[model samples]
Target chain A: MSQTFSLAIDAMGGDNAPDIVLDGLELAAERHPKARFLLIGDEARIGAMLARRPRAAKLCMLRHAPGVISAEMKPTAALRQGRNSSMRLAIDAVASGEASGVVSAGNTGALMALAKIVVKTLPEIDRPALAAITPSARGDVVMLDLGANVQCDARNLVEFAVMGDTFARAVLGLTAPSFGLLNVGSEELKGDERVRQAAEVLRESHIGPNFHGFIEGHDIAAGTVDVVVTDGFTGNVALKTGEGALKLMRDLLRQVFTSSVPARMGYLLARPALDRLREWMDPRRYNGAILLGLNGVVVKSHGGTDATGFAHAVDVAMDMVTHRFNDRIREGLSMLSTPARVPVPATAPR
Target chain B: MSQTFSLAIDAMGGDNAPDIVLDGLELAAERHPKARFLLIGDEARIGAMLARRPRAAKLCMLRHAPGVISAEMKPTAALRQGRNSSMRLAIDAVASGEASGVVSAGNTGALMALAKIVVKTLPEIDRPALAAITPSARGDVVMLDLGANVQCDARNLVEFAVMGDTFARAVLGLTAPSFGLLNVGSEELKGDERVRQAAEVLRESHIGPNFHGFIEGHDIAAGTVDVVVTDGFTGNVALKTGEGALKLMRDLLRQVFTSSVPARMGYLLARPALDRLREWMDPRRYNGAILLGLNGVVVKSHGGTDATGFAHAVDVAMDMVTHRFNDRIREGLSMLSTPARVPVPATAPR
Candidate 1:
């Protein structure tokens, strides 16, 4: 077993809580034998859940935590309270070097706040953003600020582009991702003043120099662009739309498949092929929402994440650590600071 | 024949120009014998293209114009010079009462500028918006400002709700449509300052009394909200994203179907059912990009539209006229005008 990496899992994090969290840990461990885990929550709840799965034994260890972070409390308040909460302990496990990363399906805002206050950002990064990978026509497309740092300055947007690029390269394996600024129109000046200003700065990013100018909302999964960048507000709206669209399509496809005898027979023949196709788009297989650009690694999942979703999130942490995402981010930023390709003149520094 | 509903066609408007435009005019004329068209463009090009088309004795008429609107020029500047251009002549026909509406596939900005300067907004309408119907999971979703106004205030957003609701009712043939404001999150206060304020205004709209409140991007096709409203910037992005997603899915499905022998066999067996599915998802069938709230009727089609695409756009114009979409918009807005939804507060009579 490789003891070089570990993931702190908040056993009490999701709507399914310890049960799903523990199941995910077991699944990830089986796939990644070298992995190690720390399960933090009510010891009894986690213990009982893991007892139900004897095979999970060699992969995980448990640590007791007294409090839990609720989804409703403000992010900062939750983080402040999470000092003793299991979710925070998972984060602390990494900060304290007991683990390499943390995974949770807890309050998204709390994870973000705790990661920022506890883990800290790289030297130059102003704020961290939430990035989600959508299985696009071309493959996976990284879109960010799904809902973090709502009000951003032009510089904050520049940081988002840089962070998103790193996540794409590190997570999605795109060497030099094609980045796009999500705008209302493809025209050069077609959005709010902030978006317009951000476009200029992003266009000037030398770190991710392959920026593909502006992209529209409809372009998110078009496979036309590798990375779609936007402020947290816009990103969140776009992300929600994607989720809704997928669900809607799935429901419609289900109806069509079961419509009649001929349709049912056709669906039966198409079943295996559809299975393979779905495996490619399956959210569980691709689960992971990295809070990019944070000093420490934090991976989030749906609050109702099942055993598989939780495992994917934990594996996401393992990938971040394995790739040394933060280290590379720092190196790339430093390189840009020295002499970015699209040089931002000293006088024009954002 | 309905003599009051003649339309002028800009023969040189689309990328295919006179050829496709004339083809669409012929198809549309066959469907609506009352619909007459004045084909405005170079007489030589029109004559050349018409020579190939079956000569209809009772076909639409043609008018010659020497100038053409180049796709490259600035929108306002193009409008100013295109007065003698084919597109301008088409708009002029509507303005001069020679035609009831104009159809063009030229630059949208130029079209809007021409419509605004020539035909002008309705009695109480402040700005005209471009509303395009995009293919949704269910059918088609009407999204406004696909590229109309960029910077809009709360009042403008409220206007969009009224306009969109009216379009939904008259254009989409829905009764008392459910309205939704597009925001980053579905929460009431979770968007840009403009969206937050717009939400408040829209929620109170007499026309939006049945408003479904804030909707995220995914709701565009979820069939949850009948009409999703946002500024032109976001709306345009959402509209384009929908377009791109449809294209991406089609391409992906094609690739999957042809990847393996089993998949191909499955596709063959299901060809009939799949064909119906394809027809339902085809972007061209649902074609029509209506410039809503304009002083006069103008619809933009795919710049690369074929006869079918152009025919659909023309069909949209006819339907709007037949349903009196513009008149309905005015009525909807009147019922939703500021401070008129309720009796004045006694304490705030001033």
Candidate 2:
């Protein structure tokens, strides 16, 4: 087995804590046989859980952490009191170069605050954005600024576009991923001044060929572009709105299929087809939320997720590490800094 | 027949113009026998189409409009060059006291600009907002600022809340509608400075009893509040995202239900249940996009919508006129102008 990568996990984060975390590691270990884990949490609890999962125990090394950050803890308070907490230590592992990345299912605000402070950001990146994979009409689409920066300026938006483009290439395995800036309307004159300015900057950048201009919310699901770029406020709202709509549809479908005996019989006959639909829409398949533009890869799994969902989150981090995601982002930024086909003035040094 | 209401129709606005417009009027005429229409369009084509629809012809008076605004025309260009166009004439009919309201399926930007300029806003309203009815898990919810005012200040948000509250009561037949401000997170300190300031103003107002506090985007589809208020940028994005998600699910379900022979047979047995689902999700049921805060009611039908969708738009206008929607809005604004209880200071005037 190859032993080139290691991931630090907050074993005490999330609802199920050590048990679900250990079981999730077992599932991830089965898929990534070479991966090693640095599990940070209560040593006694983790040891007992690991005893039941031999496959995970073989690949994981346990580290004791005396404190735990509660799910309800605020970011400021958590950072002040959570220095020795499992979540913070796991992040510290990545900062200290002991682990390639960090994964947690803890309080989102606390995790973001600690990760931003501990893992740090790339030299060129002002803020790290939270990106996730969403199921679209054509396939998966990458959307960012899920809740990282509340109010982004034009510069922030341009930065997000560059980060999102690199992320789509790394995670989705696309060679030349196309991107679109999210706006109310697709017209050049639509939306606010900030959005129009960002569009103009993107239009003149090195990535102009792959930039698909402004796209509306519907285009996100239409798979009109590989990447969707937006400010945190809009992106977060769009994400939750889509999730709520899906839930409502699922509930309505359940009611329809169970309203009558004939419908029940039809459901039985179509069980295999229904299963395929469920698998396709399963939340576990699209579980990971990557905090991009950071120095080390950091992923946040859903707090209520089971082993399968947690495994998917680990897989996302592994994909980033294996592909050297940060290096690609740096290269993309360099290209952005130097414009293509622009002649330098004679007075300036070339 | 009663002659209390007359609506100005932009017959040359939509894709399948004159014919669809006449047909939709026919359907609407049947439902509201007392209502009359002032049709503004190319007189030759409208008269030809109206000959077949005796019901609509009985209530319609055709007027000639030599100019027509193309769908590709920008709002500014359309306004400057389209003074004699069908859309402008329709608005002029309302301004001239010949019609109670105006309904059009034209270029949205052109329609908005013309309506705001000719129809004008109410004295208390700084800006006219676009509001729409959205289907939710619980029932119908009213969402405002769909795309009119992009960047809203705290005062603008408060005004939208009051307007949305009155709109929900007038059109949706709600007695005491509840309100929620859309934010990235549900926490009090979750959003940007403007959202927080808006929340504070709402909290201190007489409408505080009906205010549902800050809500995330998911609450829109979950029907957590009767009225959802936000800046135009975020609301537009959320609205389209929800629509896109619904479309994606519909497409995916089609593929799943027709994948195999057994699944095909199952679909036949489940046809009745599926039909019910289709009726529930029909776009025609929620077709109208109302321009609120205007002196007169203005509804924009989807440009690509058919006769049935256009009829729905007319129905929304009739409901507002019959209910005296603008009167109700004035009453609500008066209540906002006078607070429930005043905490007078030593130097304040009584």
Candidate 3:
């Protein structure tokens, strides 16, 4: 709990900008007393906000960043024109070795582009994937390539599996986490050639024993595996669909509880237990989406999140830094590169 | 109601086979009154079950099929060796003009393959898509390509849009249902080339006014559009993910209500209202998945569903038959084939 580390913060990012960023820093400061922050944003504004929060001020050092990246800015445009932006400066800090990690709630496309271009990807990684912890029936499950790569080849999928496995271990503390490649069916012949090829490689690699072959979408929420590997397009859709379904259920539950006087009374009697359910399902508990396979830790918080949610993102970055997530991924990749004991056939039987 | 139309039933299909099939027929018999059924299965087994249901027996003609296709049978194997299977015979009834449609609670892969080969695709449709009704916050939403074609070209997507639009009109009674192509984002340049090309074609087509450019997965449950069109892989994953999330929420709610004595008392008082919510969200209500763009109506019921769920599938087929769903699609396809008012740019700006 007393481990010393520093994270570069994008103070002028997200919807509420400096306010929520500073407030979240205050909460994070209380939790990680030994951790230091280099707040990169408009100096005058961040300085004024820090003046109001004595706790955040004690652990934060203001770094002036005059420019700001808008939510609607294109990734390519942001990279070309956002050299002095807060998001850019925060990432720069990580690249320059001034901070161990960077946390941003800015435009996701811009953040990914900047981090990949500035901080760069790990040597063995083809592409750095967007990985996040999603809620499952049994517990938290990790899913990756969430809109980072719309089209993924077999090699990319194999890399994602390695990164996801290392991620679950470093963050979730799973000793030997089980993972599955997302497919239309659990059968080997379910998906396209690329998916089938990826499955074959995983089945023959170092992680073969822990590989669950293939899993359907329901298996995600059913907690059939600890890590779910998928292409960016499908993963993004599945993640959003899960979120929308949960929202619909919550809405319907609210309507059911307020339908009549008796129903309202029932809600009052069940308030205690219902509150526990609410706490368990809180979106803030799973806010940070790490850009895995990157040379340095990069976490993207939900743009619309509040102080508590932002604080949770910081916690995720801290965990990745302290636990040496990148180092674990490097080890996993090396193990994957080791030749298989039994040579896999050129075209494995489906 | 008295305008008679016959449907072939695969009585030797599903987990509960003849019993649930017969019970479903009895229910459908009451609802349709004058509708007749050509029940295909083992003679002795189906006959005995039908004889017990006086209402179903009064409106049914038994067609004995010697074989039954197991759920695990591969599509190729089913097509090659399952000539006399109840499912095959049922689809054959449609092909031979003995029945207007066919309903089966059998292997989905076998059902789709058999239906494509036997019932055949429409003249204008490049490929048939699997379309199903899903619950949304606003109302029922139609999603397509749930697992028919793993990879689709721009033409296949445009065809799906036209068929989906017609389906909404015939089944959901939405005269001008707005539709959106599912993607990672609503931005023009977000997805692969195929999706972008499909969007351009749809925007220039006859249904252009009713076409929402692009939609994310959450748009399905938000009811932002009536029809959500995507390739088989993503659609299948999104559908199951939504189902899994709903199941998770339901399980959580049950746990909350049974956690303590007061919570149990609260459940009793709120039973009536919660019952309404349960009925509204019942999976049986959305049991049928129609194979769209086919020459004849082909409905696939969930293999493990019970009598009520089977009956719902029958209801969906009946709706398609009575509403002249195929005729509507023919008209829609003609409209699409007509020359556009303005020539779409070969490479439209993103």
Q: Who wins the TM-score comparison?
A: 3
Clashes per candidate (backbone, < 3 Å): 6, 0, 0
lDDT of 3: 0.89
Q: In terms of docking quality, how is candidate 1 classified? A: acceptable
The sequence of per-residue lDDT tens digits that candidate 2 reaches over residues B181-277 is 9998888878877778778778777677899999998899899999999989899999999999888888888887888888877777877998889
Model 2: how far is B157 from its true place, Å? 1.1
Off by over 4 Å in 1: A1-5, A72-84, A92-98, A185-196, A202-204, A338-350, B1-5, B47-59, B137-139, B337-350
Native contact recovery (fnat) for each candidate is 0.52, 0.73, 0.77
Most accurate candidate by DockQ: 3
| Colliding residue pairs in candidate 2 | none
**On lDDT, who's better, 1 or 2?**
2
- List, for all models, the DockQ compared with the true complex: 0.36, 0.49, 0.56
Encode model 3's per-residue lDDT on B1-350: one tens digit a residue.
Answer: 23234689999889999889999989888899878888999999889889999999998899899999999999999999999999999998888878889999999999999999998999878799999999998799999989898877777888899999999998899989999999999999898887898898899899999999999988888889999999888999999999999999989989999999989888888889999888888999999999998878999999989889999999999999998899989989889844432343333111
Candidates ranked by lDDT? 3, 2, 1
**Model 1 alpha-carbon miss at residue A323, Å:** 2.0
Per-model TM against the reference: 0.90, 0.95, 0.96
What is the C-alpha lDDT profile of model 1 across B46-131, one tens digit per residue? 87677666532156677899998877767778766777998888888877778778889887778778888887778777677888
lDDT of each: 0.75, 0.86, 0.89
Please tell me the interface RMSD, in Å, for model 1: 6.1
